[model samples]
Target: MKKTRNTQKQDYVIDILTNAKHTMSVEAILKAMPIKVNKTTVYRILERFAEKGKVHFVTGEDGKAYYALCNDCNVKHEMHNHIHFQCKSCKKVTCLPYEIEVPELKDFEVQETQFLMIGICDMCIS
Candidate 1:
């Protein structure tokens, strides 16, 4: 298998997501980037990553998308059966480690599921 090389901007974006403590929005990613990258470029990279199963995104309560690196995903299959929590006070999104069982639907196909819980995080409570 030939592993394609990543561009400078792509490398930067991956590094930022890899080191992030929680999921980040596109705007937040752009702000954290050291080099100048346009919005379209960031969106493109993130989309590609998601397609390749390297990253995943969740829609927050504010209707904004937040991205985070995938822990156990691959190009063949991407499974995210966990909860996504957003801190209302800090406005940070995190992929909780807990897993939830998806109920079987009769004569219906379930492709994906997202469970978003909005509340004040521990940091804000302290």
Candidate 2:
């Protein structure tokens, strides 16, 4: 398959984030990118990543959020019932759904769920 420039950027972002030790802000992403892209373009790419279950988001204490990769095996993460970790110290957000479960409520039929966890990451605390 032919790779589009946007796809290439997306892949670059993913790889960079995967190896990164801290959450990447928009400025960080833009500065690290080899290609010239505006803030809107970056946000658009993130939105696509979120929709595809490739990334998850979290708001930090500063009210600025970060995105992390969503790892799943058999079941695709349908934005349904998952937990994300936001370390207070390092400010890195990590997706950890094992600690959380889908809410069981008879009153409502859930279509989409996003569970997020915020706390001190190991790297941050140690």
Candidate 3:
């Protein structure tokens, strides 16, 4: 058996995602990174990770994309039907533990689903 090597950029992105407490935008990710990287490169890496089920993202009402790790997904299956909570006050996005089963569509295959709630979070309320 052989293992694939992760690029330095990918490793850095993974480290950032793993340590992040809330979903982060591309700008936020770039600011948190130790070294500056091209915006396109960062987005590309994030897109790859999302496709691989390593990370997931939700677009904010403001039209910015926020990303978080998919703790339940694996290489064989991509578990991404988890709920997302976005704090209205702080504008922070958090991945909720709640997972829901998607209902089937007639003559159609569902590839992805997004269940997001926007409101004041506990931290914001306090």
Residue 123, model 3, lDDT? 95
Q: Give each model's clash number.
A: 0, 3, 0
Q: Candidate 3 at 108: error in angstroms?
A: 1.7
Worst 10 residues of 1 by lDDT: 71-80
Native-referenced Cα lDDT, model 3: 0.83
Task: State the lDDT of candidate 2 residue by residue for 1-109, as single tens digits.
Answer: 9999888888878886787655677767888888888788888988888787877666656676576666453354564345666776766666554645566689887
Model 2 score (lDDT): 0.69
* lDDT comparison, 1 vs 3, better candidate: 1
What lDDT score is found at residue 51 in candidate 1?
A: 83
Model 3 alpha-carbon drift over 4 Å, by segment = 1-6, 74-79
Model 1 lDDT at residue 93: 96
Ranked by lDDT from best down, the candidates are 1, 3, 2
Q: Mind sharing the TM-score for model 3?
A: 0.87
The residue-by-residue lDDT of candidate 1 on 65-95, one tens digit each, is 9999886652233557788999989999998
